[model samples]
Target: MNEKIKNFADSISPLIFLDFLFESRKNLTRLIIYFVISLGLIITVFFMQLSYSDSSRAGVINAFFIIICTSSALIGGTYSAASITSEKEKKTLTLLRMSGISGVQIIIGKIVSGFIYMLALSLPYLVLTLLLTLFGDFNFFRLAGGLFMWAGFTFFYLAAGVLISVLFKKNASANSFFYFSMFTLHFLISLLDEWFYRPLYDYSSYKFFTNLSPIDVWVNFSSSHLYGSTYYGNDGISSLFNGTVPDYAVITLLYILFSIILTLFAANIFEKYLRWRED
Candidate 1:
């Protein structure tokens, strides 16, 4: 059992280490650009809040910041996806294959690196968001819960992106697939909501659709409107009422579950689909 655990750890470590080495290359450039853009936007929002009469200016500003973090996560996935596909293009994937690393390791490493890079690039803005919320009289637990919700969504996006990276050999092809997947998921949910969940929406149909989509689960985790969503309870920050909401402990665990499922799903596909061409 110990040996099995060690081997499993060994497989993922090199990929994680490689990410650190590769960090000096393309990721550095992305880190700089993302930081500059994110910080600049946060500052702009902060200054703009000075002119607003509403004391809830902090809520408005934090919402704006959270939106930016969400956007950064999306963009981060794109960059991470592109990074892997570009390696495939450069023929380095073959070398990694020959080096005794499995596809699982490669994918896991890529996910870890991408997640870390994103956390690093966005942490400052996130801290700033929290700090402003603190001064702005926002609920501490609420703000913290929202950030955890964001991380869950981030993992989902990153896994989907890595899956796309593995499936497509070209950068454009991979990106196109990513966007198509995004659109399809969004479009289907929209249809379900408008046609089924709207005026006369039924609980049965809502459960069916939401079950198939962790994205909906993610949406329910963040949006107060969606907390009482038909399928799931918004017990966390998603709770609409001023009742006793669940703490970050519960929210974080749920998010981690979603992230683990997505990551494992990606790894499974990477092993099942790509092994042939890679070998």
Candidate 2:
């Protein structure tokens, strides 16, 4: 067992990690500059808007939450969607593949990069969270719940992005495919829940099956947020390890697990692609 673990670890390429780290570091500087500018803007807006404000805590929270979540989706989604395909476009992916690094290693590297990128983005942005406190009394759980759910969801999407990029040779094709497919699927899942899953939950273990869809996992928390979905009833890092496993946390874990499964599947396809290119 120990040998197997070590082998698995050894299979991962250090080069991918190094490249990802370098790319993340490059972005870090830009993010810091943006943070500084945004902070100034926020303070200016805050004082200027204060005179005209009649918003409650909940109202402000929801508005800010929507803005942050939307921005994260757009930026994170674009970055991830381009990650693998950009390498492919530059011919670097071909070199990496021919260099004897396994498909699994490549996918692992991309996922780790995504996670590291999330950290690189999120850590400095904590100051924004502090800035958010100015709007009203901040609900820690809401922030926690949003962050946890987004992290898991982002991981899933990042995997999907890499998979799409692996399947396509061009950056434009990969990005287009990722965006349209995810949007369509998100809608389809919402419809299914509305038409079938919601009424059947009391009588079936459908939530489990539904939760299997990352779309469903998202809807479970996001849909209910309109009515103040603040607690970590079954989600997030803190809720995952203490005592009973939260159902949502379980779903999040399933996402990570499925990500691995998807990565393996993508690797298989990637290896086949490499073989085809050689032939």
Candidate 3:
């Protein structure tokens, strides 16, 4: 068992370490700047939330959700989408392949490294927000649910970015497509939810469409947890679950399935591309 564990670690360590070292070497200065900016923004928001009256705790929570969701989508998506394209542009991808790393290893390494960087940028702000929630009479379970939802969304964004990066040869093109798709999806969902579903109080339609938006999923689930069924026209906790499974749980499962499918698709494309290059 120990030998098997050691072998497994050895197989992956080089890929992870090399990717991390390369990223740090290339973007150390930019990373430092981003960290400073993110820290400043988080501190400012924390203080601003503190200034709000106790009665406005819900507003504060909503603000935090907005910040987290926007940052995760933008920063995570950009980094992940650029990870492979940047390597190809630098002409180092062939060198790595020549070193005997499989295409799967390359994809996995990029995804892992991108996820680490994303978390580094996101976790501090999330922790600060969680701490603030403690003083705002928020339920711990609700906060946990929100965190889980955000984490799942972040993973989905990273996976989508990776798939996009593999599809587009140029970093700029991949990034443009990624941002455009993300914004369009979010905008359309919000418009539909507000302009169509909300006015009609169409519970079925609202639930179906809003679940497509990660932001809405988080908001609705968290609101159900915090305010119970009374908050959403009697469609709350009970409405969130179908039999035994919660609506958020169903959404999360779908996201995970989609991510897995995208990753597999990217890996197949990458492998074929590598083979074609060799020929």
Candidate 4:
């Protein structure tokens, strides 16, 4: 038990994680620029559509989802992408391997720390959303659903980033591939609608294909009105009161499960890319 505890402790040494966070803080300018641009764009969009014959509240909510999802995905691509590649690039993995550190330990540390960073990035947006709810009839329940959806997206991207980090030698290549693959995952399915799947929207296989994108999960959540939605996201966030499962809830569960699978897969093959040099 003592040995197990010690291994876990060493895996997530506070000093290492703190330094990692410090480096992130050093990139404050880029973070701020991204925040400002995304926030400005969404706010502008909300006000612009408010004057039109549209659902202002729902529009803003959807915009917030887009911003939050994009930011969280970028965080995963950067932080998780570097988790293993940095150690490998600096030749520190050899020392960790020699020091009796296991692949599982490394992954746990990376994911835990990356999750913290992801939360930090999302904090401002969360606060803003809360404040918005105060003045409007904005459903707090919906906000909760959106936040849950973002968490699922965060986990999925983090897992994908780690797997990419393991496969690529350089962080640059890993980040690029992470972004490309994720975009492909989320966007490519929709293209089928323009050509083939649009007419078959009600088909089981069609529903299955649409469900593959996290964006679809968010869309399902955004469509809910005052009353809670049903199992397949055919209702609102208040569905818990109605004893029905919301669509996002099911998708979030799937995301967590998929992330676990990806993490395990990465850990299983982690050692192939690490080697020790003796003097």
TM-score of 4: 0.74
Task: Pick out the ten consecutive residues of candidate 3 with the lowest summed lDDT.
Answer: 229-238
36 in model 2: Cα distance from truth in Å? 2.1
Q: Which pairs of residues have clashing backbones in candidate 2?
A: none
Per-residue C-alpha lDDT of model 3 across residues 160-188, encoded as one tens digit per residue? 89889988889999999998988777656
TM-score of each: 0.70, 0.65, 0.77, 0.74
In model 1, the Cα lDDT at residue 262 comes to 70
Kindly give the stretch of ten consecutive residues in candidate 2 with the minimal lDDT sum.
230-239
Task: Give Cα-based local distance difference scores for all models.
Answer: 0.63, 0.62, 0.72, 0.71
Tens digit per residue, CA lDDT, model 4, 1-279: 999888678766853586466767888898789678758854765456445433565556556766788887877668898878888789887777777767776776677777778777777666656555544565767777777888878888888898889888898999988889888878887565446655665533444556656777766666653234433532233344464666666777788899999999988778544432333
What order do you get sorting by TM-score, best first? 3, 4, 1, 2
Supply the TM-score for candidate 2. Answer: 0.65
- Evaluated at residue 255, the lDDT of candidate 2 is 72
Best by TM-score: 3
For candidate 3, give the lDDT of residue 265: 83
Q: Any runs in candidate 4 off by more than 4 Å, and if so which?
A: 1-10, 31-55, 98-100, 138-140, 190-205, 225-243, 271-279
Pick the winner on lDDT between candidates 1 and 4: 4
TM-score of 3: 0.77
Error of 4 at 37 (Å): 8.2
Q: Per-residue lDDT for 190-273 in model 2, tens only?
A: 455456656654634333334445545554445344354423332233243663443455676777688678778887897787
Which candidate, 2 or 4, would have the higher lDDT against the true structure? 4
Ranking, lDDT, top scorer first: 3, 4, 1, 2
